[model samples]
Target: MLRIWKWYERCLSIHPVKTQVVSSGVLWGIGDVGAQCITYSTARKRLQCKDAEQECKIDWKRAAVTSLFGFGFVGPVGHYWYEGLDRFIKLKFQLRPKTVKFVAAKVAMDGILFSPFDLFLFFSYMGLSTGKSVPQVKEDVKRDFLPALILEGGIWPIVQIVNFRYIPVRYQLLYVNIFCLLDSAFLSWIEQQNDAPWKRRLGGGQGRW
Candidate 1:
């Protein structure tokens, strides 16, 4: 465990910023699917199968969509947003600001920018993967999105504030990944709640594969 943590630390320290964000996003997406697979998929059954081929045939389509969403949407955006927030707070503090006021402004700005994007990405990914009609998907997106926004946006700023303040740039990815693991678990639960029965069946339970 210590060795694995050390390797993670090294990866965060050595990789380029873009590489760190993209890799973390991709791994986060995979972790989501992995959690689902372990929690609800046929992999949990210990079934007797022919030559292990069946075991390998988990649902790639869902995983692909999830990964694409994570890598393409979440990674780059998160990187930029984190940078932006850091700069914004620093600027605010430098401009004759009280600590409470600066912190409040920073948190508000972050929520306004980050919440909508987060909702859009998650909802878009779900809509694409589930093949839900546009109206239906949009409605579902609207319904669940705010809760997700509150959940993620609320927690992330506190962490981000600490991260930006103290943690070095080289350690950002590792720091974020630890949070991502928790976020991924919550996201998996949300996905399970929002998915249709048929979609769940197709995904082999909560789209695990």
Candidate 2:
């Protein structure tokens, strides 16, 4: 753990701010793809045991596009929002207000602003790819949004508070990467739950495996 922390610190020292955020965002996106692929592939292999290789194919194009989007959109935006919030709360300078307020504000902004836009982008992509109707996709987005808020907003504030208060600006992406990895895992489970019907039709089975 100490060695890993040292390497993380070194990376922070060497990378530019934009580079760090971009790298972290790309990695986070990759993590999402990886988590989904892993879950899907594992289920396919265990349940079907046929054409598993084909089933396991990761959507590199989708991942790449989404990664670029994340790097361009979420990374810079989240970084700045965090910076501004930190300054607003004087997080580094004070402890009286506690971290809860800052966390609440961050979560609120994320739910109100960032999440809606993200859901739009994601649903748009899904609609285009699946030829699903706009209203159907919109319903899907509505179904997922609350869970996303619970997962993202609920977790991010605590993480951000620790990140803004303690971690240096240079290393903020490192904190985000760690959080995003865990988040990717959670989203993978959520996606699996959502995909159960598709999987059943494809596999003619009930269990995931």
Judged by lDDT, which candidate is best?
1
* Segments in model 1 whose C-alpha atoms lie over 4 Å from true places: 1-15, 37-58, 92-105, 195-209
Q: List, residue by residue over 50-147, the lDDT tens digit for candidate 2.
A: 56556466667656655665576656776676557556655554543336655556556655775567645654554455567877666555555455
Candidate 2 weakest lDDT stretch, 10 residues: 200-209
Candidate 2 accuracy as lDDT: 0.60
The residue pairs in collision within model 1 are none
Q: What is the lDDT of residue 96 in candidate 1?
A: 31
lDDT tens digits, residue span 113-134, model 1 = 7667766778767775778887
Model 2 lDDT at residue 89: 50
Q: Candidate 1: lDDT over CA atoms?
A: 0.62
